[model samples]
Target: MTRTPAEPHSVPAELGPYLREVVHRARAVCGTHLVSVAAVGSVALGDYRHGRSDTDVTVVVDQPLPGRTLSDLAAVLTHPGLPCPATGLELVVYDAGFAARPSGEAGYLLDLNTGPLLPGKVSFDPAESPAFWYVIDRSVAHRCGLPLYGRPPRDVIAEPGRADLLTALRASVREHGLAEGHLGDNRVLNGCRSVLFCRTGHWQAKRRAARAVAASEERFRPLIAAALRSYERPRSAATELPATDVRTFLAWVAERVGEAAGR
Candidate 1:
């Protein structure tokens, strides 16, 4: 059953129906709060190289839950005959306060002063990002769609004003990064975005825009130096900054966090 991901048995063909099934199951458990759901990850991005890709479905609730509650949501995602590496799912509850902070959609965190999901306002404006990240790929943006709540904004995707088919992948990216302490999100997208552009080269503006965020090239110095030096370079060559740079940013972020706490 686990064949290399390629033509003939392309992932979408095999996973499309299976993924929809999982979403249905998730919807059943989520009830009113399951505002949206979709297929993400290797399948969504058309890059399931070999052996097992999880079907990451995101459910944005009407209310955001504490980090601990998200663990409970993880348990609910598992069920029989699921094809994903594990019935993996990402659950984000809407809270205006949290939405106002930076976060990653396709796994890139940002600094949001507004925008919350689940019973809160979730803004997807590209203007708020500091030079670190800015452009919003339609596909990635599509993944942020609140399907359960109804369709998402039509303009944020690749084919401006066209129906979106990439939201599923972006939604999964959100949770995928969160699950792996964000190593999965950041590292994965650094490469994913690269391939994405290779395939959808038309949206140069959006790709370049994301470069600002990916500019944290030094964000995972040791990790990047040791692992894959995957670079998504439309905006900048930030995939290879020294690891120490990332550490410095982290420290700065920590101080800001502390300042916020003190106030």
Candidate 2:
């Protein structure tokens, strides 16, 4: 049932034309059930890096579609109907009720993520693990999410409270371990962003957060600088900071977040 992405719709110029076509194809397949389509993460933040960022998309449906219909929609998105501009897409289809409900679990009916690390392949999670990242994403979307179609992000996503967000951030760091390999840059930057958010209730992109903290926290300058190089540089030139340093940085971040959370 996989078909090519076609047609085009108006969206942010940064999303480019290929993605716009994919959006149109997705809507065509979903028909009346599709409620809203939004761009989250870096693309929505106006800081998307052509090769380094993933196109994070959230699709809301009025109700659960039939199994066949869901499969078709997935095919439309994953079939490489258009040349993807970034690494690839991390798409989630959510039921309208769950989307509108005041919960931060995501409650998605379908989840798919693919990228250069997983070229021409996708990971499907019908029952994704509980993570604070989802909560953070919703919060970002509520504040500055880009709507491609349908209702506004605020109406579609419930506002996650600061207390809950902090709790989730702490748990995420404790359990996920410090990410390694290509994810090392994001792991460090995200850790910094989480700590800053806990202290300031402000959301920031990874590079911005790294710079913000590194400016005032001289102790973390080396670690943050290395992360910035890896994050901003091409993958071939990305540097790996020593494992011990990464662990130390993460430990420091965890402690700061815990103290801020009063845990």
Candidate 3:
């Protein structure tokens, strides 16, 4: 079942060696049980930035991974052993059955969060994590994933329904609005992307989606531009958006997603 990546040439030059190493380590750990490896998120969307973006990857396996395998995977894939080149590496391993018929539920076998910007945690229990974010991630991966180790993504990953996506988007927008600390750039850009997805049911890079929203929603042009500027800069140079503007933007996006769901 294993084959060359569907679009091997599409991978960024800087990521080639790192991703290959990821595959090698994964294969060494899981052996024949590993079904495939696919690159998702900004990397797959062709908007990856060296110091600003996290590399998101999804791995599908023939069956649930044992505790020993999970431990070995964490030991080898996390920092020091197999250093991540990007800001972080957000890898999720899912059973093949769950991947083929996904739902708005926590069904992952392993949720590995590593790197500088991300929390260095490896989660195995579904009940211990929030389901909405993973649900949205699965939806995006199904639509935009680029295969790196096996069969094409669309063959193994099922796209969640429009209603499910809208529900997840609404929850995400609300969470951003209520969350504390510094997520200014993430809030505004995510708002832009959410609204665009609500209207079009399509996925685009955050910056690209912001530009598309800015073109149509004149009122949010300034906010969108600010978000874009902050997002493009290195992490140390990133700027925060006004809290009031971010709240308003998220509210508007949540309303839009709600409306889409009703329709």
Candidate 4:
């Protein structure tokens, strides 16, 4: 079930004063014309696990900052309430006017123009960054966003050397071969996109499978065990090869979209 947003949309005791300090730093770095800043990831989702979570927030300015705004805010960032050496989950800044402008369709999953960071723009950047995939592979619904109104964001338009990415996702599938682990990873990635892009109901079945992957390390453990079994047959605890099953597993993932598309 979806949880209610914190009572005040603005910062409150819930985030503690320390995090607010980060917001202030973000505001100064972003300047006064910015639109909104709010917690986004595990912390915002209320799914954060102490020590396991990093702060995720978005700072929307009146216009886009030069680049890597994090570098500027980094100096002023600190907090006893959250943790030290905070990392990942950026404090992105963008101008409201630009955010509202429409970015032509492309490969990116979230609409940059209207992304959580900008709030009203549309972008088509390929969204191919490794760190971007990392978050999608880990959390889906938690991060997938929908505008309260207006059309949903589109995926980055870059066709990322489709043959290359597919070859890689497939090679990894064939070699290491863990149905559940990779499936879960794919699920999270696709699920986040599906939800962010407003395709949830249409892709619900796949999302369900992705959720299972999130919980099944043992099923996936077999892949690593298979590698071990190769060298230490006698000592190997693995029962059989996942080669055949991995193919089928991948097929299931691929049926949806992107690299996993078994086709």
Candidate 5:
């Protein structure tokens, strides 16, 4: 059975119009196959930064979408056609079966990445991308996703087991730490959020998680504070975080998550 969309007033004022446009375009393309549209990531977590955060969205369809429909949906929802208000739009579409019972692998019908921060690409094959990110995103969606077009997230999306989440978190930490070049504030704040989730089994806004971690972890206070400051500022105006400190913080967080998983 189809469900009504959530109230537009429930989201940030700036995003209300953009989201409405997205739903309109998606409905036009997918028609009856569309099952739900939900807001995830920073928006759903209630700490969305106007210029820095990407608008992360999840769409569920009744079954696998044909190639033509996927192309049509991507054309309308992506940049230029829809114009994302945030840094970009990271939208993923999953079949209802996969949304209800996601396996250990990446299983999505469409993965559309658009805007300035991310490379513009439309991927249909799961093999084209990494699996860990999808797993973690699903965990977050199941926990706190806000329905925009259909049934509540928890009703259509299943939560990954704690162990599986921890595994994905560990992989994420490693990937962030090992990557070369600018580590950025996201690494630090994501580390804080990952550790918080490992310990409490709940998702939190990056800023809130950084503050909470700073209050308790005195050793990482300076690092987290710097990260928070950078995160709050506009992406171009933000100061650079110390790469060494960010990597060190991620290592500590990984250890903490590993310990929690062992318990």
Candidate 6:
């Protein structure tokens, strides 16, 4: 048996070219050290919305690369010459050994967040970072990832543990200032998704999951409606939601998710 090359068409057209460029650049830089590349988040879940999503790619390496190789890969992957399809790109690199482990803290070889919110920066040795959110990321990738190269996602990534997911959810809400969380589309939708994951042990796309939570729980309707509208028209000033309502909604979600975790 032989491994197949990545199918460029696996990603949406908006992200296809950029992703192809990334794969080529990574292969050029990492060579045999690079194990696999997979697409996670909305891109893999088949609910990606153009102009409102980030292209998320995870590349696995056989082992920790030499600093020079890691730096080279970062330079090519985060180069400004390659424009992302949407807000930005989130490209993470992981070690194949750690990724294959059944359970433990996952180490990232490199993590890059390039988008409107922050300047394009690449980091090395992210094992000590408190904001390691790979628990949910691994879960999503294991269940719904779109492979670009090497083995399937389930072959490389382990299912995230429940305790880890709850901790990540708490950290997310806490960073959002609990009751005073921002009312941006991502913020609201993520809050809804966290709540849903806690309750059902399943992951869902932002808008659909938000709608589901809203439908099941009447109290979340107004906030979820505002979030859906914002998602539809992200740049429209006309869609700004009331801050007070957003605060209350965040508080409600935080409380509910906390309760769910306790169960």
Best of the candidates, lDDT: 5
Q: List the residue pairs that clash in candidate 3.
A: none
* C-alpha lDDT of residue 19 in model 3: 89
lDDT of each prediction vs. the true structure? 0.35, 0.72, 0.84, 0.36, 0.86, 0.76
Mind giving the per-residue lDDT tens digits that candidate 5 earns over 1-263?
65677787778888889988898889989998888899999989998889888889999999998999999999988787677888889999999998899566779899999976667989999999878888888988888898999778878888887777778888888877875533478888888989888878889998988899999999999988888888888887877877787778888988998898798
Residue-by-residue lDDT tens digits, candidate 2, 1-263: 22222223334455667566667877789887777777888867667776677888887888988777777877777734554666777777778777776564645677766555434533235445565657777787787777777777778777677677777788767653546234677778888887778768887877888899899889889989989988887655667777787788889888988898884
Q: Give per-residue lDDT, candidate 5, residue 178.
A: 77
RMSD of each: 13.5, 4.4, 1.4, 11.4, 1.5, 2.4
Q: What is the per-residue lDDT of model 3 for residues 118-175, given as tens digits with 9 covering 90 to 100?
A: 6688989878887877888888788888888987677887887767777788888888
Q: 41-147 in candidate 6: lDDT tens per residue? A: 99888888776677788888888898888887777766465666677788888888888864435568888878663357678966555542676688788888898
Q: Which stretches of candidate 4 lie over 4 Å from their true place?
A: 1-15, 66-71, 78-89, 102-251, 258-263
Clash totals, every prediction: 29, 0, 0, 25, 0, 0
The digit string of per-residue lDDT tens for model 1 on 1-263 reads: 22111233433564545545555654565555544443334444444422222333333444554444444444443332233432233222333232223333332121111111112112233343322222233243354332322223122122322111223223333433333433322434443343234345323222232353345555533443432333332112234444454444344433432333343
lDDT of 4 by residue, 53-161 (tens): 3445544454545545534454454232223333223333334443343332122222222112112322324453323332332222223432111122112111223
Q: What is the Cα-based TM-score of model 2?
A: 0.87
Model 3 TM-score (2 dp): 0.96
- Looking at model 2, residue 196 earns an lDDT score of 76
Of candidates 2 and 1, the better by lDDT: 2
The whole-model C-alpha lDDT of candidate 1 against the native structure comes to 0.35
Off by over 4 Å in 2: 1-14, 119-126, 180-182
Candidate 4 shows a clash count of: 25
